[model samples]
Target: MKNRKPLVIGNLTARIPVIQGGMGVGISLSSLAGSVAACGGVGVISTAQIGWREADFCKNPLEANFRAMKKEILKARQISEGKGILGVNIMVATQHYKEYVKEAVKNGVDLIISGAGLPVDLPGLVQGSKTKIAPIISSLKSAKVLCKMWDRKYQTAPDLVVIEGPKAGGHLGFSREELETIDELGYDEVIRSVVKLVREYADKYKKKIPVAVAGGIFKSEDLDHALELGADGVQLGTRFVTTKECDASMEYKQSYLDARQEDVCIVQSPVGMPGRAIQNEFVQRVQREKLPIRRCHHCIVTCSPKEIPYCITDALVNAVEGNTKEGLLFCGANVWRCDRIETVAEIMEEFQ
Candidate 1:
């Protein structure tokens, strides 16, 4: 195939194999994602409460969310000069899950990467759109089941597969007990396992399924190591959070700057998934129950108001708004090393 020229694996086209990990709550918006895509990498916009600023969100969630999603995609596409691929990361647990994916497809999003849940119906959602669909998985078993199910039901395979290890930020893949038991565990084994399974499916279907690995990958060496170990590409999330182009507040960005190695700890999310985040006053307050879920945003579907300790949406929004004292700050394991803010070019240069 003559190397395939490193075109975008999903629906978009990029000059390089690097795919920007999607951040949310206005973090990886049009400005940041467009710039990265324009720079020759796949730029991803997070569809996580992206319409948060829309005045009609609270009153008319679906209409407002759809509108904002369309606007963001168009904005990102325009800013990228129509170069590179513009993709979206939509969590499966969010309210109106299929609606969000459909909205992205309707808006001409190039690709959709879903996580935080199985997203079993992902293929069905993008049935007629030209958008490519990829589900994020953590293990070989999960990948096999999803691919098998998609193949059987939709006669389609994942355009790409993202194997996120336990060290990733936000919602986690395993139980707290499991994550703790394997703390600091290298991802090579899991990556190889998932890649092996993906290869089997690829061979059977006579298609190429490029495997991308994530979680705790920070520097050029880390990327090189993954590539050497069979990863076709890499997904970097936490490292980009500190970039000046990131839409996060200065306080939030500074939190990463002030973080220590020990400060990055695994904590329980209000949605019941184990997550890695910076140990800050907000995290401590949640651990101590000093801060409570004052208002209900009804963001995630799996969360029960009584069982969940707090409303994740409100907490995260608070952090994006710069209320570090009581906000929820989600980050990957390498967040502690962020010491300063720089441009995406500088961040990407480090990997070069």
Candidate 2:
């Protein structure tokens, strides 16, 4: 194994250069995030419908989410015991996106990773806070646009940047058509281009903007590949799902253990984006016909309850709760490679 350097962003540092990507809808919560952080890696909690289990969630989802977000951040801090980094992943498309950012900042999270859309106002949102901001982008074009906009608007650059490719899980940045022919996309070249562009901006701004690559980053070899491509770190989501400390139910983890390469497929999410997931009964049924939307959780900004196929929140909640038959199991392209459950410490040790 090669010696790896720590991941540094502003004043914060992670002993390991691996970030546990944020999985949503009760999947990656305090338990998972805190565990990873304790292991000297950046552990991220997804703020997507994070308050699903709160008693007031059904009636006052936003308030419930705000309260839960604060509690989760505090709990993760306690669990981390002052080690590594704790960050929150807030989707730009989520309802009350600004409020969620404020809540995360107010809770004093170490970092904020935003995606699912370009988080153009993120710099302004976290202006005076010690919380670092990173944007999740898919292409060089988007990266250039974001850097230019942030530099021009706020006189600042991203503290870190995450490049999430087509193989990533849940609410991807690519079009459905583009994802279908992803084999011909030459995404590695894109990664290199984005890395080079970010380096230029880093030089111009006179600061370090560490770049991390997400999607299909499953093992130690994959981490080496990303570093070889000029990335400072790797962000992994699916690889952590089967971890013993992950917040998802045992049955949800089993879905990954049972998955085969052929079982992974792309699906159109109600959030108006393409996502990669294990093709289960619920996914197949949605592809065949539109399922009923019992009620809207008001999760995302683009979701239209009456016309959409099904509620993403409901499906994800089901998956986290162990209803594999009906839940939407969002996973990375390499999920099939997962064979067993391990602790966060064990997974972090592999990167070392």
Candidate 3:
């Protein structure tokens, strides 16, 4: 592993190849991101309803998000002290997806890791900036499609390709039926195939596209396994949740630390995708009744207040703020294994 070298995406480099996968609605903001970057890892902040904690977020959700994104990026850079990578995770399914990328690039972000949907046109948005693009893919088919689209349309390939497996948190790339058979699909086998699939494109385009694997990655052994399977790096999300620098409240952090293996399960998200989360009282309530969304934040174009269940924005914010009973506690499949809270530096040491 010592001979593997650091993660290099375009001009930016991370001393450690672990990217702290972005957790949103206030999780993994400046505090967490900055600490990870300063520790020589790529730090990512999720832009999903990023400004929910802001005072004026409800009235003008879009405007508030733009302002908060700028602030978080600058704060993370300051924390990094110009070391490692400062990146943002903006979902392609976001209502104003292009605007988020333009704003992040405008503020001189180091990287944009787009997922939750295919980001075929991401390159065009960051054309003039130093920011690099990495599209998250789950299967060999998606990987080939993304590479082909980018190559034909922009004459380019991804600077980095992130392979997210089924055991991931938040919204998943797989369908509900597929989530049930995660073990049958075999995560290790899937990663190896996708890595092999992308290598051809990397060689053909004459680019050293670093392939990173995300999902259920916990410690040093997990990191080794991903590398052993042919990935250049591993993206750590659930492990970061218990860190002191994590932006979520103490209760939120404790939830991960307190979770048991049985406590975690796949639940349906309002965005029409299945997600892994803690099976808490909040989750049970959502399943029992259709809690109406009183108002719309206009976050995702496909969402509506009058038609959907509860407002994901409200639920996630509640979770971030420590309202355990009513909060939507999104987590990875391995989150229940968390035993204690540690610093970002301490956790990064495991991978080192």
Cα lDDT of model 2 by residue, 1-352, tens digit:
4669989998999999999999998889999999999999999999999999999998999999999999998999999999999999999999999999999999999999999889999999998899999999999999999999998999989999999988888878899888877762499899999999999989999999999999888888988988999999999999899999999999999999999999999888887888888999999899888888877788999999988898999999999999999999999988999999988998899997
TM-score of 1: 0.94
- TM per candidate: 0.94, 0.98, 0.97
* Count of clashing residue pairs in every prediction: 0, 0, 0
Candidate 3, poorest ten consecutive residues by summed lDDT? 1-10
Q: Stretches of candidate 2 above 4 Å error?
A: none
- What TM-score should be assigned to candidate 2? 0.98
User: Per-residue CA lDDT of candidate 1, range 37-82, in tens?
Assistant: 8777778999888878899777775677678888888888888898
Q: Between prediction 1 and prediction 2, which has the larger lDDT?
A: 2
The prediction achieving the highest TM-score against the true structure is: 2
Q: How much lDDT does candidate 1 score?
A: 0.80
Model 3: per-residue Cα lDDT over 209-321, one tens digit each: 88999988898787787888888898979989998899999999999988999999888888888899999999999999999677789887777677778888889999999
Worst 10 residues of 2 by lDDT: 176-185
Sequence-dependent TM-score of model 3: 0.97
